[model samples]
Target: MPSETPYARLTPDLVLDAITACGLWPDGRLLALNSYENRVWQVGLEEARPVIAKFYRPGRWSDAAILEEHAFALELAAAELPVVAPMVFAERTLLHHDGFRYALSPRHGGRAPSLESADQLEWLGRLIARMHSVGARAAFAHRGNVDRDTLIAQPVRSVLASSLFPSSLHDRYRHVVGRIDRLVAARLEAVGPVRRLRLHGDCHPGNVLWTDAGPHFVDLDDARMGPAVQDLWMLAHDERAMEALLEGYASMRDFDHAELALIPALRAMRQVHYAGWIAARWHDPAFPAAFPFAAEPRWWEQHIIDLHEQADELE
Candidate 1:
């Protein structure tokens, strides 16, 4: 594993070999591959059982992050949120190899919800609301200002400064960062203290799946102490779909001014995190094509335009 490669670390044979060594998975064949910050392979066993083996980007995350997810997934499941639970197998104590960390979970059978479906959007909202309710009932407060500053600094210092992207693209992202900074600044001025709780940090469409068990959420590697609204904002970023989600969430709980105020900044932050992550791992074999660079730049540009227009609304 190179220090700078954004790719996942496992090949099909390697993953199958690992599983077979455990003696639980037999005659399993790799069926599909998925990657973002980590690489995940969907494997089909001889018995028709499916499981997902995930190997994280070397040094991008830590063992503690995965442990936090397991703890919170249990909490959320106890509160009736639909989360995919991974079975514990051998050497599962946060195994480390080739400078990367890896973990395994059951393969969820359903696909990510399409934006074209209102029913899916509604289900997403309700699922988020239930997760929020679970967080509200938790004991601790949100962790403050940790990853936010790093995200803001990345484009100007890391991505742009690194020369990994073309000069034209670098300038475009710099402008996006400027716009994001302005929105975040204004939001901080207007929003009051927000209640914080444990969150599934990456709650976007990709992490959500419509399954036989109902709407199931996966990829809890970023789980940490943060605003539940962070999770909600990611799902509700698009206006029409967001409106449906808000309607569903509101059916269960009331929203206050501060939570609403944070949406614009959070949305931009979500994009920033995504762009940095995608750029980091573009060369990885398992990198998903859902938001290719060609499409993502346009999306971020539109976000900047929207942010400029909606700054006052958020304030």
Candidate 2:
């Protein structure tokens, strides 16, 4: 509970104790996984293979919301999709010990998916479509939706409040963010009312783990409600890439062509959100070490320029 490090109290001993509390015996081997919002680890076990233990960001999600995420992942797994749902130890998924909440999943190994290949993109598109097919079945009562407020406004507010934000470009940052807020809103309005289903919420390439068997969707921690296109846009970079994605997507479910226009808006929102996330987390010790550029005057100045250009594209 240190002011600077969110996971300061989550030492190796605490991580091990948390897992053992779940009735799993640890073998004293822990490999820290690449995660920021949550502390994840590959914990060795006594009688079984290693498991991925994810310690949630304290107070970020209500218990109900976290359960909603766990439920969604279980649903996808039940549907025979390649989602890594939390393991049910003693019929419970959410485990608690030493004042921290965490969940454990059987570890699955895979390298990052090669996004440059059409085969890879299409394969991912189909899996996502099938996942979305399940996502459309029901709505999450606790988890929020993907919208301008969550993606753009809240993050902008966080950035503006940051001491790390370059004072010289403060006004410029505000002006550019304001333009993006308005332009993104207008674009969504013009798209008309589209279906908002449960989404992977953060479906970028990084969240996906690919194997020869296909993609294993990891990290439903960002799970929420959104247009199906929200999940598809992040996987495709260019016009052709998006087309390839949709080609595979269409194989399983229908695509709302209107959602295609929502891409630029989503992209702008994500750009804004990333800056906001860094600013909001700057107080964490890990943030400074991982994103040293946040403290640089030039980075903030260039960020404003980049965001201004993104706002223009949204227009």
Candidate 3:
């Protein structure tokens, strides 16, 4: 059975009330509600601006993850970096009425880049470096000795164990997975311990926007202290994108060869991670078919296969 709409339980009057309670404009009509995860409306009250109302599911992510995102948004804003600034109505108590958390942010006035533009990529590099300088420090001010073995092993093995790929791409994907597995194993043997750093975690093109201001980053739910390369892996193999992102980052920070090598591994890992996430939500009613990969099973399957193949090629 299809799950109820995110706002199914919420009436127009109640939604208005929620909007009012949150201190956002309550008069504007809800323009769109996607797969029940988030609601977007044009707020005429705020000079006809667009603002998004994001609703959090209970079990999808941890409270720590939410808090971490909150920290990232505020810290980036403080640094004067171009990012979506989220406002929490009640701080720690975002959800007083429902069993979900809520946040409101200005709708970034741009679309996800349909084509890779060098200018945009360059901007991305500069922006990411700035973000890292300011945001990285705060997340790890109080840090822990996060184990590498588990981080690498769990995600990789989970993909293999769960059989996330469709049967059609089994051969192609198997070769790729095998190659990545070998490379990961070799890295473990050679390096012994994996290095750690603060990361945006999900730095995909979908999460980054090209607005009038420049490239603006939106989602930070996956923000955490982990291998820095882990963040790069989220981006697809758009060389222009990588060139722009890396060159921009290099301008501010220095990354060694080891970190560069880890890029391929992290990319492969991220592909597996995302593919698994999609597969898990395949049956979810609330999961919107907003993503390109949603209706394109063959594309997703091939992506996983290609990632592993690239891993093999790297080895």
Candidate 4:
């Protein structure tokens, strides 16, 4: 059954027609990739290699913001960093068809990088350092900063406004996030004015693909301006792992150790932001299907407990 959501009009026929309009003939093979924020597909071509088509979620980002993301990926690729840059079509990267905006990229395949290996961690660090070197050369004009307002305050409001959050836990949720907000603010203040640069905002293991050649970064959808540690902290699991990454990072560029203190705060912000993200997307059928646990009362209770734990970590 076709979803009655905003994407109901995005049928497979529309997908094929959109690609055909882009000057590529579809082979009628489409595999829906693992994505919820936006619809992505592994589309086969008539006589050419398969390409990935990413359809942007409506009302999520303005055209200028999306273009900025493309430019950053291109900039990183131009600097010889292993990032998947959008495939240009007819002198442009962003394309429009059927009231939707999308981008095409050549399909590259690899498995998730092994984070347990010190060597791999160091290698990833160097890659990130190089990316930051390019990222620092310019600032985003359209994309907002990854600060308290976007990561904490706005998300809290979304949760409060949404019905997905259990009514019984409302006061507890508000109190927990309120304390976390203050803690995050104090932590940022203590860190002082740190150098902000373009970052792979959602740098997690899933975004990294490891092959014989090394790691290749995919998806600049979450790219934004923030502290360099925002890109590095998620990749590190512990002190030793962090040391390995920083060791390689220091070799390529200067790193401020002070950003280390911001990790726990950042982690807390992510927790709050994640729940908000789910709540914001509850209207989308894919969200409920994939995150059924979010609907359960026990899950909300556990979420509250997790927030308390994060608060303790912040102190």
Candidate 5:
């Protein structure tokens, strides 16, 4: 049973021990956070406020890639941005305990950001622009990119390899995914070359924590090199909201109106990638519990239909 998942050895005791290893005392309270790619928790402390302990998924990211993420966060924080940078221990941000790589951060609380308010959307856009300005200054030598391999090819491979994919529909799945791969690639090619920079990578509303002062970004774990639009598309819900966001963004950095053309292509890519992510992670106990529908044949059927529809939109 221990062989079932990579996180099998990450017990609560191990989590607390990891905190202790970093010279902090945990108060025996552990709350598992909402994360599927990696194991995260809110661990209490006896002498200080609660800290977030995130155990990295084995082999998902190399040590250098993880350090680059931490360095980016620290760089943003040093610029007086509200991003939560990881706490350093023994002069290192990335640390190890019992063969697991984990990091700690101070907990910040906030509710879902209200995108309905144009002012708020503009505010978020301004912050994103500022983040992008810093992101543009450097390149991530060890990180991945938001490209065909990550969003399309690799995910399609996962879905095709997944046991949960309906065996009867294997041929059909391949046809749809392959077509999507081609369409997405062609669309990206048509868009010409867009400026790629370090981005929050997954900047949906959830990653943002709002306070009385304003918003502070959390979870730079997905940070990587990509176009600036990758950070903006998720925060804006509609044309009006996007306009307001761009208004603020324009005040800070130049916007590639052409990058807007990539939105549909990017969306199609995400649709393909999301299914692959779920299928690839199905072995993780949390994924099954969180995505029970993925276990059913109907889900696969619907997924194929969705992919077909995505292709239509792309065309």
Candidate 6:
């Protein structure tokens, strides 16, 4: 068996073999996709077009949790929303081969959605509202929520434990993060208890692919239970953009104006969580290669400044 850091063992040959084991004929053409947490490949089929194979990051998510994400994507697809769901094989979406768990999905291609366009933003808003409508129907049994514990507290713990975090900056990092933590907590308390529902948890524009047919959502790996605004804030860049999104969202479902207040708090949490994410994954070669800037002391200095800025925003 491979160690926890198994990507070293997941060579091109192993990836193709995994596909062949799943009854698909690989044509020996494999393109590594843009993914860090999981190893994703664009593999050409024997006689058919290409498909995407996503190998789950070992120890990152349990089987039940991965299935919960798959089920949620399937649910969104069932509603006719343009979401890329895992392709089931032999009555199962989660398949195992060579000590790794993976799933296959048809390759859906499109450029990034134009967040600058009001019309496009509105369209995305409606889609998100519809997704939230279905998302509100039920809760995930094995999946977790997007909250302080998952995004902030846990990440703080991870960074502190990680050797990647510079010992020289330890006190500075702790002080800034501690202030941001208190500020975030106070902001959340000020917002009070807002509605929580299943969300696309990481709804950045990069996840949305825009084609003539419209936007298709990809990568539900970060999906979790959170406020509906968690999905919307990432899409809106300014007040006008947000207004357009809410306009479209209001057309489908009632928009809770109160959720807007949670955006800054969410942003702060994401900032903290992102640093932690890089720290936790620094052991993985991909992380350091992709985020070379994170290794510099100046980066940590700037990060401290950013955290302080976020604290000011919260205040």
Which regions of candidate 1 are displaced past 4 Å? 5-9, 90-93, 96-100, 114-122, 137-147, 168-176, 237-243, 282-315
lDDT of each: 0.64, 0.90, 0.60, 0.92, 0.90, 0.91
Candidate 4 ranges with C-alpha deviation above 4 Å: 1-4
Tens digits of lDDT, candidate 1, 1-315 = 565454434556677776665555647567656556667777677775677777766766545656556656777877777797556656353555544466666776677777657777777777777887776676432222324575566634655543335655656556657766776776766776677766777788788877665678987776666665777766664678767877777778675536766776776665566556655555554443655542345655664565455544444
Off by over 4 Å in 2: none
What would the per-residue lDDT of candidate 5 be over residues 198-222, giving only the tens digit for each residue? Answer: 9999999999988998999999888
Please give the TM-score that candidate 6 achieves against the real structure: 0.98
lDDT of 6 by residue, 1-315 (tens): 454366888899999998998889999999999999899999999899899999999988999999999999999999999999999888899999888899999999999988889999999989999999999999987789988899999999988898777899899999988898898888888878888899888999999999998999999999999899999998888999999999999999997798898889899999999999998888887888899998888898899999999989888
Clashes per candidate, residues 3 or more apart or on different chains: 1, 0, 1, 0, 0, 0
Reference-based TM-score of each model: 0.77, 0.97, 0.74, 0.98, 0.97, 0.98
TM-score of 2: 0.97
lDDT of 6 at 17: 92
Tens digit of per-residue lDDT, candidate 4, span 76-184: 9999999999999878999999899999999999999888999999999999999999999999999998888888888888888888888899999989999999999
Clashing pairs in 2: none
For model 2, residues 271-314, the per-residue Cα lDDT tens digits are 99999999999888878989999899898888889988898788
- Poorest stretch of ten by lDDT in candidate 3: 142-151
- What order do you get sorting by lDDT, best first? 4, 6, 5, 2, 1, 3
lDDT of 1 at 164: 38
- What lDDT would candidate 5 get against the real structure? 0.90
